[model samples]
Target chain A: MPLIKGDQITEDPWVYADDEDELPSGDVVVHLERWEKDKDSLRSRNGKLGLILRSDQSPELVADDLAAFDLIALDFPAFKDGRAFSYARMLRERFAFEGEIRAVGDVHRDQLFFMHRCGFDAFEVENAAVLQDWLEAAREFTSVYQPALDAKQSVLRLRHHTKKAAE
Target chain B: MYRYDEFDRTIVDERVKQFRGQVARRVSGDLTEEQFRPLRLMNGLYLQLHAYMLRVAVPYGTLSSKQMRMLAHIARKYDKGYGHFTTRQNIQYNWPKLEEVPDLLADLATVEMHAIQTSGNCIRNVTSDQYAGVAAGEIEDPRVYCEIIRQWSTFHPEFSFLPRKFKIAVTASEDDRAAIRVHDIGIQLVKNAAGETGFRFFVGGGLGRTPVVGPEINSFVKKKDLLSYLEAILRVYNQLGRRDNLYKARIKILVRSVGTGEFAEMVDKEWQFIKDGKYDLPQDEIDRIKAYFAPPAYETLPATDATLKDKIEANADFAAWVKRNVAEHKVPGYGIVNISLKPIGGIPGDATAEQMEVVADLAEKYSFDEVRVTHEQNLVLPDVKKSDLFVVWEALSASDMGTSNLGTITDMISCPGLDYCNLANARSIPVAQRISERFADLSRQHDIGDLKVKISGCINACGHHHVGNIGILGVDKKGQEFYQITLGGSATEDASIGKILGPAFSYDEIVDAVEKVVDVYLEHRAPGEAFLGLVDRVGLDPFKEKLYAAH
Candidate 1:
């Protein structure tokens, strides 16, 4: 698997850990259940922690503990189930999580742009050969209509600015 | 009409470029049909039963003459020289090759139109009353808010993929011409006791498999909180709506399962977090959009045109046409003229390229360079003057666009069923044509008066059979086509789902069955009572007895 960040495919330092398997040493990502059950022991580990929330889980469940993790990964069980799009926005715009937001599971070239717009900075794609295609997908549109976590100025704001400048 | 600004133009141009690349990839076999389906659908291209069908959205049913001419161009160059105006205020070209769609879309973009969100499971084109700015006694122009929503929902990141396709309709007049009550989300503009204009929201109304009139969720959401409120509702639906079953994915099912009271509570809780945030519409932004929809320039003239009166009296045909096809305009000398696409025994909603060019010419010359596509599959010259009525009729008649049956029994709302739709189980257009031929006499149609006959090929109800006064659903009974009838339905302010009347009628029997139902209404109706009113006063018993007694 390859990870896309910004305009390039970068080396992924984080490793996903299964619940029954032994925890990896550094920069480990665990599921929500594992993180909730072993909170005390995981906090004592010598690594940066990350949490993966499923499509059915909301970001509000970990609102108070958002500062504990260096990354939050949202899962799309299927590409058509889009609950995680809203969850990614809530993690950035509402809870103000500044860590890495990763999109995992069923990530494809078609959805990379929307996932990027919804504040997903990293995507764990299945095929390493299509990394360049995924990167291009994430930059498909030069402008957008609605404001999201990205810094791109919305068209509405641009229209108002243009009118004001002419005035 | 709202003209595209610089930002709007840039976005549509980029969209066309992006889709061109996507179509290239699909042609080279780099992308499979499974992967390319949603991408093409998002741009409003569908692979129908015959060839590719391209649905071009007419935003809020408003069209400039230049845009109408462009539609005529597309029809002449790409399709089979015709287009179908749909129930959702869209125009669908029934035949276009896969390779030619990118060029077709580029042509549309040049006219400030693209087929965005017309077929995808995203927020569809926002619809409003066909008579939006010109309708008398409207609280405020609904197109202003409809355009606002159009900008906000176009390529919205968080809601591009939801549980199912979403539709939103807005209306400001007391008369619900836009059919707001049966949409996924219906917004009615209202003035409060303190004389403040706001929105009355209706959530989860739909007309598919299980038809339900959306219940009122909030009485009045202030003007500033409109976008925030809609975002809240979408957030709730995206998070909790069912995705496991395609039939149960609409918002109406979600509202029914959790109950409207509980659904509203969930939306209110979501609104608490983002109500007054950056999504709240600023007064300046609203004003900017509002400026585009200001009243067109008009010369002062008397209310009644004496020459028009004399023409109507001297010519009985013109009088009949005016009586059925014209509506009062807010401006004194202007009239809203409805040009029926349903000629006697012809296909409903099908307009030829020449007819489209004729309408474009008429709009440019007589009606402030504007036209409207009504939800009833008709075209509207929204601001024709009373004095120009005879000439407009003459032009339309020359083009074969004048049927003079605006709301009569023959002006039906039908779908491109088994003839062109893969999802259909039986044919719909042929049945509609038969019924139209049976009631081709204009005098008899006017005498019967204001009966809506909607037909669908399947239970998906794209034809809105559930809301028709006389609803007909075509079913496939063991590989044979059969039609089922329902009675006592209305899509107005007093909206209700029709109840099924008795058994199904075969292909040979459906037209006779419809005639019998109409005959029963004509035989036992109070004077001046509409078909829907008659159905409301007397239930389906009389219709059922006449329809089934011969067995």
Candidate 2:
């Protein structure tokens, strides 16, 4: 899998361990059930820690434990299933989770812009062919209407300032 | 007539660019059709039965003359010299090629219009009363809030891909001209006990395979918390709405499964977390948007126009048109003129490019450059002066746009059935045409007054047959086409889904069946009683007895 971060394709150092698989040594991401079952063991292990949540899994389940992990990967069971988009926004704006929110599973170039705006900073796509398109798609819109987790100024705020300046 | 500011202009231009790239990728085979369907639908492009149909959003049913002219241009250049004004108050061009859609969208964006969210499983184009600002005794103008919701829902990241499509409608008057009760989320502008204006919300009302009138979720929400509350409802639906079954995907189903009380509680709980956050609308923005909808300039004049009265006395045809098609305006000496698209024995909502150009000319000259599209598939000049009524009627009559059936039997709403839609089971336009021809006599139509006959080609109810006083739904029995009739549905403030009559009527018998139902109503009704009132007085038993007697 290739990872899209910012405008470039970068090496992904995180290893995804299946639910029944043995934990890898360095910077390993485990499923929610695995992390829940072996919380103490994984917490005491070496290297950085990460957790993966399925589309059905709510971020509120791990709200208290967000500080323990360095990354939270949200799964898009299907591109059409937009639960993770809400989960990502909740993690960033509601729970105030500062960890890296990565989007995995069925991620594509067309949805990358929306995914990024929903607070997913990194995406794991199936192919490297989509990296350039992903970069362009993420920067497709120069202005947006509503406030999101991203730091971009909304058009409403801009209009407010413009009104003040004219006054 | 809200002009696009720089921010609005930039967002629309960028969206066009983005869609152009998507279309290029699709055409070059980089993206497959399965992957491109949702993308195209989100931009209001649908692969219909014959060709690509492009639905252009007429925000809250409001249009300027410039925009109307551009629509005529698109109709002539891209489609078959005509366009269909839909029940959602939008216009659809039924025959544009896939590759030409980007340029069509570009042309639309130049005039501050686009087809964004006219389809797809996202928050669709916000609809409102066609008589929004001009209607007498309106609590407040609903377009300001509609514009607010439009901007908020456009490209919203969190809830773009929900379980199913969402629709929202707004109205500012007690008369529910916008049909808010059948929408997913209906907002009514009302005054609270303190004499302050706010919104009363109805959640999860829709007409589809399953028809349910949305229940009022809140009596009154403060002005500032409107978006926050809407966000709360969308978040709850996006997270919990059923996605496994396409038929059960609408918010109406979720609201039904959990009951309105529980659903309202869930929304309230969700709102507790985000109500005071960034989603709370600022007062300044509301004021700014409201400024665009302020009352236009007018000279002091009497309530009645002497020239109009004399002309009405001189010409019986003009008098009939005035009596049927004109509505009272809040301002004195002004009238709200309804332009009926359902001409005698013609396609119900179809308007030719010539008609569009004529309407644009009339709107520019007489109506202060504003036009409106109604959910009933009609057009309105919302601010026509009484003095200019004769001239406007003459111009419209010249273009074959004049009709004296505003709310009569011939003012029927029929969807583009098997003729254009792949989802239709039977042809609806022919049946509507037959019904119109049967009731072609204006005197007879006036006798059976204020009858709404809505026809849907299928159970999806795009023509809003579920809420029509006389509803017709087309079905396929084995290989042949059949029509099912429902009576006693009303889409006004008192909303209810129609009841189905006993059996199905074949293609040939459906029009006669409708006539029989009307005959029953006319015979049994007291003087001046409308169809729905008669049906309410005497339930479906009388209609069923009459309709099934021959069987």
Candidate 3:
């Protein structure tokens, strides 16, 4: 899977660990259930811990242990499922998670812009061929109307700033 | 009437470019239809039964004469030389090709217009009272807040892919002209006891398979906290709204499931964090948008013009039209004229490019170069002089646009049913036409008086049948089209969902059935009583007995 960070498609550093698999030594992204069940063991391990939340799972459940995870990956499940977008924002804004948040599963070039706005710093898209497309899509719009976790200068702010400057 | 500043221009231009690329990818097979559906929908493009239908947003239903001409141009150049104005105060072109949509969007961008969020799960166009600024008894123009919501909701990253589509409507008038009660989120501007302007929030009111009247969640949210409150409500809905069932995905269902009190509590909890945060809109920004909707320059003329009275006395036709189609404006010497799109026995709300040009020309000449599209699927010249009534009527009458039946039975709100919509169960236009033809007599229509007969092709209530005084819902009964009737519903200060009247009627019997209901109302009505008022005093039993007597 290609992981896009900002304008670059850097290699994914975190290894995704599935159920029934032995824990990896380096930074590993585990399923939410697995992390919940073995949080102590996972934290005790020398490897960095990360949690991958399903679309239905609330980030509030894991907000207390948000600092334990080096990265958080949100599963889209489907392109139309937007729960991940809200989850990503909650982890960043409410949980005050400072680690990397990656979008996984059904991540497409079209959703890159919105996903980026919701505080996803990295993307784990299934297709590597559209890396350039993803990069372009991330920076497609010059202005945003809403204030998001990305803290991009909203159009209202820009206009207010311009008027104040003129004054 | 708001012109795009440089930042607005850049945003709209970028959206066009983005949509252009998305369309290219879809054409080149890079993106599948499933992937492209939302992208296209966000741009207000839909693949219907025949061709692509592009819904162009007339922001808060306000339009300049120039924008109206551009719509006419698009109708003539791209698709068929006609367009249908919707009940949401937007216009829809039925026959545009997918290949030409990008160009169409680009053209719209030129006039500070784009089809963004007209469809899709995102927040749709923020509709408002058509007579916002000009309407009598308005506290303030609702379009200022509507434009604020429009900006905040447009391309909202966290909300663009919600469980289902969202609709928001704002109204400043005490008389609910915008039908705020049946929207996903309805904001009514109110003055507090302290004379401070505040917002009253109504969450989760919608009409579809399940019709719900949104309850007032917060009676008073300070003007500054409006956006924050909205964000909180949306965040709660986004996380918890039912996504498993397509039919139950709207916020109305969630609000109903958890009860309005619980939902309000949840939203209030979420709002605590957002109320004074960065989401609180600045007073200067509100002032900025408010300036765009300021009352237009008007000549200082007498409240009543002698020439208009003389013309009315001289010409009976002009007098009748003035009584029906013209409304009292807030400004002196000015009258708001509703140009009837529901010409007798014509497709309701359908206007040809030539007619649009005529209206545009009329707006520029008679009105102050401003026009409004009413949710009743009609056009309004909001600043017409009382003196120009005769000339305006004459010009409109020449183009077969003057029907002199505003708020009459013939002035029906009918959705583009099976004729254009893929989701339609039966035809709505034909049924509306039959009803219109049945009540064709002008005197009879006027005598009947102020009756709203809304027809919907399906239960989606796009025609807003649920709130009409007399509601008609088209149903498919084992592949055969059947029309169901409902009575006593209203979209007003006293808003109520219409009650279902017995069994469904065949398409042929529906018109007569409607006539019988009207005749019953006429017979039972007391002196100076309206149809709805009669229904209110004397219940649906009278009309139902008359309607289903033979059956």
Candidate 4:
């Protein structure tokens, strides 16, 4: 129930609304089925609504509802199931969703660096004891080579930039 | 030959530290084995049958003398004083303590090497033609693109955890030495109508339970768009590749289901968005990487050296070795020398630390200080001068490295089956040794020229048995080990999977059956026809009859 947002752990404000429970105040996260069923009622409430997507679920299906949510958390289910990493990137890069993208369920310290690079700014880690480990994991590598939604300057770009500066 | 810059060094060092911490956590009970398996696998470590095995990536099969010595050092210190070269052009140390892996990786990082992506479900070590830079008539150096792909695929955020492991092979020559047809994604550097170099893409080619040669997806993609196109393909596979069934998880399965035409269209449509985007490789970066692979310094000499001729004439063994182990290099007076790891009855790719150090010394002295690991599980000194071949031969002969069995029946590609691999159903090394001893005589092996007998302990095809000229696959028959034979498979330019030759034979009868098949080939062949050529000329019926005659 801990949320990591850009090197800092903060209290998770988003509450999951179960099928039988009423929608909570402030920001609330619900599954796709719940969002589909209570879209009108959730919009009429005073709080913003977000949807939790499984690895099998596609963000393209909810492209029209991007503007209505403050968070879109992609579920990993297992760390080996990497479909959410792609989903996060697709949400940010393709669908152009500008919200707090989070990684949920079975997130490990080893994957936080890549999770951030894939456009997931927030992580829902189960154990708060390993929060420091997770923060250190995000800074494991000083440079990367590939272009991603995170837009960190790559080593190749840095090399060229340094060479040009010297020139 | 690609030297690691400051950035490269830092990345590898950071990875080593991260893995070190992870290993410490795993050993101290902070992480469960299930939680640590993927992490260790990403660093190329696997818990085998007896002990932990660490697979070190020999990227593109290219290595410098310093790097080779480092591998040898790791073998001597961390392992059982020897390492097994895999069919993927990587090396595996069968015995290494889990705690010592970080230190081992740190030593590897000193030489700009790490084992990342060697065993994970990520894009595995990008393989290329073993003789990439020196091979004659190559369109361009394939390692350039292989290096590009290596960078793009390393720790890639989106495609790192794919449905299954992915493999990519690249070849710049007209003859596909890298087995471009049987990979998940194969790239052939070709010239288009405008006389500019581009890539011909092949998707869905793999060998396993179902062996299929990948079909061509795009005839030609421009050079500038290689990364974008490849990213498109990976994006499509990551989103739609089968996640429900492990057996049908490779991109090849997806390509088969969707059809190559439809897959190609999807890739093309995906390519539209990213074709001109940030992944487009810049010319300066390409030039920077290309500079690392420029031709090594060479002395000006005649095409054929007289000293080599004189030495060969004097020593009959040297002459025989020259006929088999030496290949033509692009540079005048230089030859590509294949040092056979398949000595008469030895393991296919096992090299002791002493033997490795000897090769490193020989490479430093004779071959421009460089070595290469071939997918055929042999070592290569790619720039040996023809005049220096005799000395190289003598040094190698001292260590039993010069067997004069390159590309012969004895020079087999074998996987570490049940002997070390936990996934194997039957043992593969003893069978390979039996076959090698059965055909040990140098003259006899030469007489049966260019016969590749690849053996795998299981159907995973780690030994590449599906593409061997005389393929032998180890199968378990009700707790007994039996072998299935496939004929006419060639991993060369004319890549084709061999057809099964009747029922499986017991281990005792497998070698004799192979001998019978060879006898049939020897009896019914035209002049200048190799074993593969002979099988092509005549169908598999004759060999099948001879093999299945008694049983």
- Per-residue CA lDDT of model 2 for B352-414, tens digit only, reads 999999999999999999999999999999989999999999999998888999999999999
How does model 3 score on DockQ?
A: 0.85
Candidate closest to the true structure, highest DockQ: 3
Candidate 1 true-interface contact recovery? 0.75
Residue range A1-167, candidate 4, lDDT tens digits: 87888677898888887876876778888888887887788778887778898888889888898888889989988788888887888888788888999999989888888989989999988877878888888889988988887768877678788888999
Q: What is the interface RMSD of candidate 4, in Å?
A: 1.0
The runs of at least 3 residues in candidate 2 whose Cα sits more than 4 Å from the true structure, single-residue gaps closed, are none
TM for every model, in the order presented, reads 0.98, 0.98, 0.98, 0.98
- Give the CAPRI class of candidate 1: medium
Put down candidate 1 lDDT per residue, B294-330, tens digits, no spaces: 9999878899999899999999889999999999999
Q: Provide the lDDT at B437 for model 3.
A: 85
Residue B353 displacement in candidate 3 (angstroms): 0.5
lDDT of each: 0.92, 0.92, 0.90, 0.90
Whose DockQ is higher: candidate 1's or candidate 4's?
Answer: 1
TM-score of chain B only, all predictions? Answer: 0.99, 0.99, 0.99, 0.99
Which pairs clash inside model 3? Answer: none
lDDT by residue (tens digit), candidate 1, A46-159: 989999999989999999989889999999887888899999998888898999999999887888888888999998888878777777777778888887878788887777
Looking at model 2, residue B371 earns an lDDT score of 96
